[model samples]
Target: MAKTTPATRSLAHAGIAFDVHVYVYDPGAERIGMQAAEALGEDPKRVLKTLMARVDGKPVCVILPSDREIAMKKLAAAFGGKSAEMMASADAERLTGYHVGGISPFGQRRPVPAAIEVMALGEPYVFINGGQRGLQIRLDPRAAAQLLGAVSAPLVA
Candidate 1:
């Protein structure tokens, strides 16, 4: 197992139980999320991809299934914002203190408002980035939402 990152440590500190999954990362892979899913031999639907966005000019997170696309309008509505747009990769990295492909919903330098894809809330378990490339954390979806303070919404289409 890899050394504990902020994401895992935060979950641990919160007394949350989860499984750590590490897999080889193919830098040449076309999509980071799909790469992780394939490498881990898991359904992409059960894996999540974290995205940074600006909602009404505030940093926010949108977590959704690897195979899904976020609906910007729904995301904005979820947070009671008039507008929401994906943040530039560089800006996202700067804001969350994690590189673009490694952003986790947990353990941000400054936590932000976040929303989860509605369907993810009901999954038995979900795998998400672990604050770095090649590491993933699997946990009960419900617990993750609570820990992330993520509101559930139809953010993905």
Candidate 2:
């Protein structure tokens, strides 16, 4: 597709197939995850959104379903950290090279610790941002970890 980013390109090279979907973005909207789910005509619980947080002062990315909220205590416990808080949007953009609403586990500016709820990977289907708002990449859950270097764990409450 669009000469994919380094992360996506690497995925392709590794034989990880993916489908790209793009939609109209509503910049004024606050619920981008819901927007994407609506545009894609998929159940919100089956789709996921990426969140950037600082775990013990280091950037980390956590992927969870749009219908759920991150359990900070669970996250902190899993990582052996005392605290985890959402990072500022500016810091998120600066570190990930993607807007807060459009952050993907792939192609981040740096290799941040990534965690995906174990439930999200129960099935083969998963969708994530394609490095831009209104754009998404659909692929197998296994491919996500292989491509994004993510750790699939139990962090969703």
| Steric overlap count per candidate | 0, 0
Local accuracy of candidate 1 as per-residue lDDT tens digits, 45-75:
8999999999888889999999888888899
lDDT over C-alpha atoms for residue 109 of model 1:
82
Candidate 2's residue-wise lDDT over 1-157, tens digit each? 3536654664567788888788876788778888888889987766788999888888898988877888987787667899989899999999988777677778788868888888888766878887777877788887787666777778877
TM-score of 1: 0.96
Against the unseen true structure, what C-alpha lDDT does each candidate score? 0.90, 0.80
Pairs that collide, model 1: none
> What is the C-alpha local distance difference test score of candidate 1?
0.90
Runs in model 2 lying further than 4 Å from the true structure? 1-3
